[model samples]
Target: MIGERWINLAVPLALLAVPLYALMADEPFTITLATRATILALAAVGLNIALGIGGLVSLGHAVFFGLGGYAMGILAFHAQNYSPLEIGPLTFAGTKSMPVIWLVAVIVSAMAALLIGALSLRTSGVYFIMITLAFGQMFYYFAISWSAYGGEDGLSIYVRNGFPGLNTLVPIQFFAVCFVVLCLALALNAMLRASPFGLALNAARQVPQRVETVGLNPMRLKLMAFVISGAITGLAGALFADLNRFVSPSMFSWQLSGELIILIVIGGVGRLMGPVVGACLFVALEHWLGGLTDFWHVWLGVVLLGIVLFARGGVVGLLTGKAGPHV
Candidate 1:
């Protein structure tokens, strides 16, 4: 218990410490990297709610990620062009407000998740996995063919969206914004994990039969988890688009979805702070090993293989002596 508690607090603080030191040392690039990791960690947190807790392995989460990106893209694109978006008969004006963009992203993504989950949850195991993957690919192709929003080339935001009081143009200020959101998401995850619904979800994941015996609808619980998961991931997607000032079909790619899952596995599946640890490690490798070799992914694969075979608990599990519950 002591070790787990230490690992939980230590991982996030260490992450916080690095960026602080980087800021003090005037290494803006490192701060950017840290911010990327924080955003990715936020996305993985969403997945953890469903994958880690609900036992739903969705390879199509990129659908929500891309949806969030497009939400930002479409809104900011119209705003930048000074045109109102016309949908059938209703004319919607675009605004550069970050809060409005985030709200739209969350709502749209949640709706998408609900629609997808309603159908996908009908199947289990390999079927569920394939169905999710299929849905993701469907969206990927749709984005590719939709030339109105840059099509294969992708969309770009001319400027960063507006925040209440901060100048988001500053790298550190943007980092602060993302960091606060990450912390809030972490708090939400902690709250959900400690709630009755969380217990029921975990039980449904572990033993659906028993959950059903208790009159709890496992499908409903999973669907709710999926919706919340999508909303959070969508929010991360909006941040990611803002981070790059661009959105592309690549956001909906299988590779990004796989990386999100890999983040969860490498950090510690189902463990709080697992995604943070995973994202940091991933970004570190991308920054360091990427510069050393063109085939850095091969090395990453080897390391992941070792973890899968040897340290199933990932970094947090290895350090804290707690194995991942799902695997």
Candidate 2:
């Protein structure tokens, strides 16, 4: 069997190569599909950092994801209309720049995570999950009723946001931007996993008492991890909205959060390449299975059951014959 390290390298390489091939062959749809997978994987990666590492099973990550999407939508919307966004005593203008949008997305998502994690981290086991879910649902309903930015109707980006030195309107160029961001995020994940902070957080997850005994605040570590996770997921949400050129309340739905967890489970929890592999399989299955029948989710459900019962290590584990951090 191939080693996990090699498989990990190969998976990302294949992801890039296929998109590059699509661009060369003028297969814009294929490129778009790859881009979708990349962005979804990025979001899942964020969830993995908290769930896989810190044992934080948050069903409300959609809050941050939606926040990020809305950040982009609202900014782009205002910019397109040449209007200012006013809140209370503050007045702000919008821009179509991708960097600006991403910064806002990250900051907003991180701040929300801080607030949510502070409250949610006080609970353990299922309580934490419920709190997160409640927050997510709250945001979903709020987005639907807000009505300022199209409310339940959602917001659309008439034009793709601008990226420095690139024509984002070009499918291939936009895909490249997303791909590079995913790579950078993956690199950060790898580094974090190996860092002292990551190890401490993992240790806290397994034995909070021991971590506390050693003078580290387990809750603080977990909160920090949650915040970072939320920020990354938020960044992915921004990219996803850009890819579709739209943002809606659905982005905050509980279903989206569930799918992120499913992706982590399918790819291999705690594994570095888990989200990448899971996202690819998800997109491929949806494409193939949807064409065959309307109940593709039923098949998806069956696969998830099998993984939970038989292949706890996920696709990477099955292929490598071992479960390691390399996943």
Taking the tens digit of each residue's C-alpha lDDT, what string does model 2 give over 133-206?
99999999999998988899999999999999999989889988998899898889889989999999999889
Give the clash count for each candidate. Answer: 0, 3
lDDT per residue (tens digit) for residues 54-137 in model 1 = 999999999999999999999999999999999999999987899999999999999999999999999999999899999999
Candidate 1 collision pairs = none
Cα lDDT computed for each candidate against the true fold: 0.92, 0.92
Find the 10 residues in a row with the least total lDDT in model 1: 318-327
TM-score of each: 0.98, 0.97
